[model samples]
Structure formats: C-alpha cells, structure tokens
Target: MAQKPLVLILGPAGHTGDSIVEGLLESGNYRVAGLVRPSSLTKPSTEKLRQRGVEIRAGDLKDSMADLKKHLEGVDIVVSCILAMVVLDQKDLIRAAKEVGVKRFIPCDWATPGQRGIRPMGDMKGEIRDFIVDIGLPHTFIDVGWWMQLFLPLPARSKREPEVHARVNTEYAGGTTPTALTDLRTIGRWVARIIADPRTLNHPVLICEDERTQKDAFEIGCRLSGEAESLAAKRISISAEEIESRFIKFKAASEASENPMAWEILYPYWTMAYVKSIYVMGENSIASAKKIGYLDAQALYPDMTRTTLESFAEWFYALEEPAYAHF
Candidate 1:
C-alpha cells in the first residue's frame, strides 16, 4: 500500500493545536502526528491524542537542529501551533524542516497580521513569513479571525462581573465595525481542508464565521444569558487613545516589575494588547489585511459551515451556564 501523507503538528497540546488534530482525524485523509514538549507527556489531552493513534514525537524548542531533524524525518507537512513567546523559536524548527526537505510549512499564526502600535507578535509573524519564503519552503498562512471563545467569559473567570457579555462597554467592541469572529470548530474544519488542498499552498487563507461588531455579539450573548437588554450592565466606552495609553502603561509596568515574568504583569500586558487590537484599533490592525482585501477562502470552500454569533452563543451556553450571573 502507498504511504499516506504525514502531517506533523508542532505544539499540538494547545486548545487550537488540539482542535487542528481533531479536525484532521475527522477527515482521515492524512496520517496525523504531533510534536509535543517532553514535559507535556503526562497531560491527559496528550495521552488522549496518542490513544487516537496519532504518532507522538517529543522534543524541545531548544533542541539542536540536527537533533530536531529526526522528528521531521517523514513529515510531509509541518503545522506549528506554538504561542506568542515561543513563536520566534520556530526558526530553528523551520531550519530542521528544510534540512529534512519537508514539503509544506504552516506557521502557528491563527490571528490575522498585526497593525501599527500592536506588539512584537505581528512583527515576529511577518519575519517568520519572510524567512519561510526566503528559504523557498512552500507554506500556507491560515488567518482565522478573532475567536468567539475569547469573547465569552470562561468558567474560571465567570465569578467576576463579566464585561465581554455586557451590552454596553467602553471596549468599542460592538459597533458598525465588522470584525471577523470565528469559533474553534469552524477554525479546525477550515484548517484541515486547507491542509489537504494543494491550491492553498504558498497562500494565506482568511476565515471568519461571522463578520459583526462587538455590540452584535453582546446582544446575542444577552439573549443567550437571559439578560434584560434594556437593563444590561455597561461601562464607560474605552477609546483608542485610552487603549494606547494603557498599552504603554502596562508594558512599562511589566518591565519595571520585580518579577517581569509574573502573571500579574503579563496578564495586563496581554489584555491591553488584545483590547488595542480588537476594540481600539479594529480594522486598523494587522488583521485588517483580510478585512480590507483578499478574497476570503470560505468562498473557495463553499461546503464549510459558517457559525453565526447566535449559533455560537447557543453552543457556548450549552457547555457552561451563561456567565452573566455575576451581573
């Protein structure tokens, strides 16, 4: 029998990474494998993926190229699911893939490109893209829009007054500005199809289940949570200037803190960056590239189901109660 195409998922233990694995498995067209850190061996999700017949390879980002080359031995495609801090580390992995002659490389950039005043995250992704192209590696950048999950309040933080679900907030979330908000399942489905389709190679595929403003999503959430739209909790609207100010403040605090790596400082830094990207800057950010131009790949793949905010709210609340209880 001819061997099936092998896809090695680097950083498969993450929520997005794991979703990619499930999507690929559902398709059953590619031989799936995952590259996990050595420390993640004990994770339940890691073991679950292994039991699902995924080939498991353990290696560190710090591993030498020659040492990491073994993991790419038979990998036909490499999809990286690594996060922010470890993003630049993919350079080493890319070098190893080139050394092993992998066919296609997918970097772990699920979000759209960054814009002016955004953090080094977008800049780093751009550098990665350029490096991949310069090395002559055929690649596909899957630019899925903002995750609907982030818009909803998670279980752990539900105890506090949930702001995202609020109908009125200064975050500039809900307005006429159409932002592509997507659900994880939809992201998984699109990514799997993109990986299998040869045409998607060397191009960026933009995806968004729904293009609506923050207010639209908030209204859907209010209905889902059984909240009174008229009596919805709200905050003073945040502005772009305020967001930029907070970004500088948070970044300065993060650098000045006794433990710069502390979560207290890091959380604010992340939150500020996020608010700046989605709320303050909106389409002015890097993700605006797809928002402004490019033919959405969803048109190319008509069969892929798009999830609306109402549908996402239903699915989201089904998993957990509407977190508006605190309000």
Candidate 2:
C-alpha cells in the first residue's frame, strides 16, 4: 500500500484555511499538517484541528527562512491561507518551500482574480506569484471569483437591522457585469483536487461554480426569501464614475494618513476598489479568468457537484441566522 502525501497548511484555523482543511480531510487521500503560531497552539480552534488528527507545528510566516525550512521538512505540499495584510510575507515561505523541495506550493490567493491595478490585495498576491516564478518554485495559483457568502443578500430574519441588509443589497457600477461566485466551503474541495493533479502544476486555476450579475443575485435572493418588494425597494445604485471617484478619495486619505491605525480609512477604499474591479472592470468572470490564463475548474472537474446561487439562497434563507455576516 502507498502512503498518503503529507500536506501542510500555513493558517489551518482561519476561515479559508479551515475550509481547505475540511476538504482535504473529507477526501481522505492525504495526511494533513498545520503550521500555527506558537501563541495559537493552545487556542480552541487549534485544539479542534489536533482532535481531528491534523499534525500541528509551531511556526510563523515571518519566521526566519531556516526555521521555516526546518518546519517544512518532510512536507509534500504547502498551502497558504494567510490573512491579506501579511500576504507579502509569503516570500519567506516560498524560499523555504523551494529549499525543502516541497512538491507544490499554493499561495494565499482565494479572492477575485485580476491584474495588478485591479485591486490592492490582488497586486500584493501578484507580487507573491512573481517571486514564486522568479525563484522557480513548483506552484499553483487558485482564485475563487468571490465567495457566495459575500455575494448573497442577507436573510429577512437576520438579527441585524433591515438597514444593514439594505447596505449589503446596494448595486455597484450598474450591477449588470457578471462575476463568478464560489461557496467558500467548496474552494478546498477544488483545491484538494488541483494540488493532487499533475496538470495544475505551475498553472493558475479558477474555481467558479456559478456566474451572475449583481442584479441576478439580488433577484434570486428576493424571490427565494419572499422579500421581493421590500428588498427591491431598498436597493441602491451607484454609477461607475461615482465608484472610481470614491476609490480615489479614499485611496489618497489612506496614503496620507500617518496614524498607525489608518486601516480604518483604507478599508473603505478596499471595498470601493473591489466594486470597481468586479463590476466596473468586469474582471471577475470566467471569461476574464481564461483571458488571464487560468484553467477553469468547472471544465477540469465536471464530476464535482456545482453549487449555484439559487441553491445557496435556499440554504441561506432557511437558516435561523445568517451564515456569513460581512455587511
């Protein structure tokens, strides 16, 4: 009998990392390990991962390359799901992965896919990819257009005030541009398959289960949740010019502010920029992904069940509380 390949994930307890871990475990084809910060070793989340039979190691992305290479020893694959703020820190992980001869390295790029100027975080992710290519690391870049968790409208029975739901239901840049949507939980399933396949080696893969314009998603939510009139009435529309203007205004504010906590100003800029990229720029669709040289996961894995926006809305509205509360 052959031994299972050992896969080590950098942020095993995070929203994205946890989902990826779940998918890998469910597949039952690999041995899973996690590299956690020394301080997080005792957290309940980390303990839960341990209980589930994941080998946990104490390390950080910012650790010295020697220490990271030591931690990565014996690992066949490395998948990073680190937070956006520290994405560039993956340079050390890339170097360490190369040093240890890891079979594959999956960077933390689980968001909308676009070129350098499309989104700030996308640019940072691009920087990491450039470094990976420059150093000749065996790698795969995966981008899920946007989490269905973020795309859907809030359920009518959500605990938050109706105004909050209204804010989430706003339409940006005419809301007619189509964008791919993937359930956050399903990303790992696609990733598990991608990493194990030889064809995805050193390639970019796009995981998109469904594609719809903003208005389409809103209509589905309104129809499914029986809030057609109320939700329709609350919808707000912002033009592309307005979105661009606001993005520039907030971008300048974020760059000029000297306060250490200036992320508060930058957060709004990110939101607006994302809107511009997805809607105004129309860079989040499968067509755009293919244009940018991404292998389509839907075509690659036709056997896997695809989750549609309608199905997600059915499940979401039936919940006692909203499953994802980004609004």
Candidate 3:
C-alpha cells in the first residue's frame, strides 16, 4: 500500500482542536500527529490523545521556531486550531510549514464567514490568512460559523442582585437576525472531511449545523433549560446601531485607560468587538459566504447527521455544568 498522508494538528488540546483530533482519529484514514505545547502535556485531553496512540510532539507556538520546524518534518498536512488572540503567531508557523514542504496548511479561520474588519482581533486573523496565501503553500480556511455553546445561559446572583449570564444578552440584543451557527461535534466531522478532500484546497469553506436567528437559538436554549417561562420578561432588546456605538466607545476607553492592560477595560472592548461583529448585522454572514461560493457542511458530507439548535440546547442543559462554564 502507498504511504498514508501524515497530518499534524497544532493546539490539539483546545475546544475545537480536541474535537478535530477525535474526528480524525475516529476516521483512521491517516497517521495523525498532534503538536501540543509543553503546558498542555499535563492536560487530561492531551493525556487521552497520548493513550489513543497519537504521536504527541510538545512545542510552544509563541516560542520554539526550530523545534516547530523539526516537528513538521515529513508531515504532509498542517491543521491549526489556535485561539484568536494568538493567531498572528502563525506567521512563523506558515514559514516553517512552507520550508518543510507541507502539502496543505489549514488555518483557524473558524467563525462567521466574514470575520475581516468585524473586530480588531478578527482583522489580525485575516492578516494571518493573507500571509498564508502569500507564503505559496496550498491552504484551506474553514469558516465554522457561530458556536452553539455560547447561547447556553446559567443563572447567577451577587450579594445585591440576581441575573442571567449569557453571551446572547450582549451579542444579540435584537436577537432575530439570521445567524449561521454550528456545534463543536459537527465542526469536528466537517474538518476531518476537509482534510480528506483535495478539492477544499486554497479556499474558504462555510460549515454550520444550521442557520437560525439569534433569538431562535436563545428561545431553544431557554425552553430546553427550563428558564424560558421565567426569562421571557427579561429579554434584552438593543438595536444594531446602539451595538456599534457601544463597540466604538469601548474601543476608545480601552485605548484611553491608564492601564489598558487591565482586564476591566480590555474585557469589555473584546466582548463588544465580538458582539458587534456577529449580531450587529448577522444576516450578512450567510450572504457573504454565498458570494464566495460557500460550501455547506451538509452538502459536503451528506451521510453525516447535523445537529439542530434545539438538540444542542437539550444536550447542553443536561450537563451538570456545561463545558467551559464562565461566570
């Protein structure tokens, strides 16, 4: 038999990264190697991958250039699932992949179809996408759409006040704008399919579990979580223009603060930027994807069953505490 293509995954311990790892391993089609940072070696997910017979190589993305290049040796494909904040660090990674003659480079562009200019950090990801193209390596960008996990809400109370904490409150004030969303399980399968297909090379592909307005998603979550009746009167309602204005103000405050590094200012700026990008004009997400000849997840993998918002909400609320529970 001919040699199987060797696929190397970066940041394999992360949310999306781990999903991709599980999918690829389950497929049993290629020799999979996961490049994890030293800090991630102790993680339970990393240990699980190690036990699964995945060739685990430890190296840092922020540092370790020569080591990263060394690990890329004989690797036919490189799939990146790095976080948004550290996306720029892929510049060196692209150079290394090109130097090692890696066949295809898949960068972490997994979000709404049009992430460029939507947020400052998104612009940074766009820069990395452009750099990948400029480096002369065959590449593919996967736009996985909004994550379903973000819609789940949990009730909380301070000493003085009780409130519901959900990203939908901030991101989708006027929640009834068409939004494309995908669950992590679907993204994992879609990514594995992309890795197996040669036609996906050198383009952006949009994949989602389904498309529904943000309000639809919130309603699904509320109904499943049993908070629908009580939360009906507490829905947040804000206009798109107001969201834009808030984003601008937050950006200004982040820049003007004496300690811009402080979490107080930086957190709001980041949150506002992300909210503005997704919900301010979310109807455009699918439109932009189609303008670029977008490939749908169902069309790409017909045999694969897609997750629905309601089903996701049911599963999410069933958990003792959802994955990545944030205050």
- Model 3's alpha-carbon lDDT is 0.75
The candidate, 1 or 2, that scores higher on lDDT is: 2
What's the residue-level lDDT of 52 in candidate 1? 90
Where does model 1 exceed 4 Å of error? 153-157, 160-170, 229-231, 234-236, 251-262, 284-287, 291-295, 321-327
Question: On residues 225-306, what C-alpha lDDT tens digit does candidate 3 reach at each position?
Answer: 7777555655567778888888889899987899875778877787778776667756336676777567665677788888
Candidates sorted by lDDT, best first: 2, 3, 1
As for candidate 3, its clashing pairs are: none
Give the lowest summed-lDDT range of ten residues in model 1. Answer: 165-174
Output the lDDT of residue 201, model 3.
Answer: 81
Alpha carbon lDDT of each predicted model: 0.73, 0.88, 0.75
Give lDDT tens digits, candidate 2, residues 60-170. Answer: 888888898999989999999998889998898899899889999999999888878757788889999999999999999998988888787776567787666766788
Minimum summed lDDT over a 10-residue window in model 2 is located at 318-327
lDDT of 1 by residue, 1-327 (tens): 978889999878777788888888888788999988888888998899899989999987789888789888899999999877788889988988887889999998887544545654666787888899999888888777777776543333244454543423443533545677778765767777887788887887777777777667666756675553433544346666777888999989987899866778887786678667766566423347565444366677888788888888787767644443222
Evaluated with lDDT, which candidate comes out highest?
Answer: 2
Measured by TM-score, how close is model 1 to the native structure? Answer: 0.85
The TM-score leader among the candidates is 2
Span of ten consecutive residues with least summed lDDT in model 3: 155-164
